[model samples]
Target chain A: MEELKQAILNKGVVVSNGVLKVDTFLNHQIDPILIAQMGQEFVKRFNGKEITKILTIESSGIAPAFTTALELGIPFVFARKKKSLTLSSNLLSAKVHSFTKNETNEITVSKDFILEDDKILIIDDFLANGEAALGLASLVEQANATVVGIGIVIEKSFQPGREKLEQAGYQVESLARLASLENNTVRFLEEVATK
Target chain B: MEELKQAILNKGVVVSNGVLKVDTFLNHQIDPILIAQMGQEFVKRFNGKEITKILTIESSGIAPAFTTALELGIPFVFARKKKSLTLSSNLLSAKVHSFTKNETNEITVSKDFILEDDKILIIDDFLANGEAALGLASLVEQANATVVGIGIVIEKSFQPGREKLEQAGYQVESLARLASLENNTVRFLEEVATK
Candidate 1:
């Protein structure tokens, strides 16, 4: 988590008041070593939750989800933002609102992939507004699966995302939780243990 | 390679005349064990190559690329299918035609990621028409980077993708090359072992 916070502090660019751009290493270009470490840490944090599958959204979440699934020795399932022609007809659908893109998109996952008795963990690169996480949780509920926890690499803790998920009765864990980003300087939750 | 081929043969679904869906284990729902094996195989095959980075597209390609990059202890850079506000302003963009969707989309990567002197290995889930691979290759070229090799999980040898990449002067390696699909039965290359 220290390495992630450092990487973020070093490379993360504040686009405006609230946007933190980390394309250099976190999103567009990935540091596999750090990602693997993050995945291992997630496994350690959620070790005994009985996770049967790792779920995430497409595009940015795939890498971290894949790595975490590999570390936990579980299958990884990602919800597709768009329904491709090659995808199966039977699917579990949920409407997710992206505040950045300023639009709502329907995310679909094959009903065959998620089992009713399985326990799933949702992982993603960023958690803001908590709509995406809620949408994923909705899909899990649709499949009659249990959401063990929500793991995030970077979280804007000032936003309503954490509170929303907590209200939904889901346990949330973030590697680096930003308490505030006033004056273009990032601040952590103060509870993070420094290495 | 045998493990991959067997996975395809066992779990892969034949949709139409030309479409083979392995979403059960490869793309939609990922099998972590098989993907790890694939990462090891890619490392073994491209052992001596100076792979500074692993390049791939978003979504499907990210999984294998991350795995292979993990095997090689290198970073992975995935090209985004669309220009997002989260991405940097400066980018290397290419047009890719998706055979599955019958649509052409622009894929972009941040210019800050790939260096001119970097040796990149392109990784992807499938190579059919090869348009996506070539587009990714063009991105490397835009960065003035050298592509040491192209690693593919599955290659439809009957398609033009392999031929096109070879003609473009890339050392393309596919774990399982299907020679043909006769009567809904997949016939892989004779020398290529299916696990």
Candidate 2:
């Protein structure tokens, strides 16, 4: 978590009205070593839980989720943002609103992938409004699967995302929680433990 | 390779007018063990190649590419299907047509990721028409980077994708090559080598 905070502090940029960009290593281009560590941390946090499958959204969450699932030796299923021509038949879906893109897209999962009685952990890059996490939970619910916990790489604690999920009775854990992005600087909610 | 061919034969279904659905293990719900094996194989084939980076398209390409990059101890950059609000001003862009989705989308990559002297290896889940690989190669060209090779998990040899990439003079390697799927049954181009 400290390293993640450092990465954000050293490389993250604030632009276009408080938007934090860490794509250089977190999103567009990935540092597998750092990502693998993040995955290990997630597994460490959920140490005793029997997670059958790891779940995430397409595009961004796939890498971290894949790494986490790899560490757990479990399979991962990512909800597709759009229904492709090759994907068909029965599907469990939910509408997700992306504040950045300023648009809402119907996210779906093939019903065949998620099975009832499977314990799933949801992972993502950032939790802004918690809409994406909630959407993923909906898909798991449709499958009659249990939502064990939600793991996030970065959480904008000032936003309503964390509170929203907690209100929905879901346990959420994030590696880096930003207390505020005020004055063009990142503030962590808690002190980062330095080695 | 034999395991990959076996996976396709066991879990793959030809649906929606000859579309092979390996979502159970390959695309939607990924079998991490199998994917990691595929990644290791990529490293095995491209041994001694000085690959600075692994390039892939978003969504499907991220998993295999990440694993390949992990095996090679290098970073990977995935081309975004569209421009995000957080993406930068200067970018390398290309127009890509998705036969599966029946649409064209402009994929962009941050110019900061790929370097001119970098030797990039493009990796993807499937090679059918080869349009995605070509588009990714175009991005590398814009960066003045060299594409050392193309790694594909599965190649539909009956299609023009493998031919197109080979014609373009790029070394392409695939774990499984389907000679034909014309009869709703997969026929391997060559007998998978059993270790």
Local accuracy of candidate 1 as per-residue lDDT tens digits, A47-148 = 778899999999888888888998888898999998888875999999998998888899999999888998999998888899999999999999999999
- Which residues of candidate 2, in runs, are more than 4 Å off? A192-195, B16-18, B192-195
Candidate 2 residues A35-153, lDDT tens each?
88899999998899889999999988998999999999999999999887677668999999999788999999998878998999999999999999999999999999999999999
lDDT of 2 by residue, B102-154 (tens): 89989899999989999999999989999999999999999999999999998
Please count the clashing residue pairs in each candidate, in the order shown. Answer: 1, 0
Q: Give DockQ: model 1.
A: 0.84
CA displacement after TM-score superposition, residue A1 of candidate 1 (Å): 2.0
Q: After superposition, how far is residue A112 of candidate 1 from its true place, in Å?
A: 0.4
Residue B57 displacement in candidate 1 (angstroms): 0.2
Candidate 1, position A72, lDDT? 81
Write down the lDDT of every candidate, Cα atoms only: 0.87, 0.88
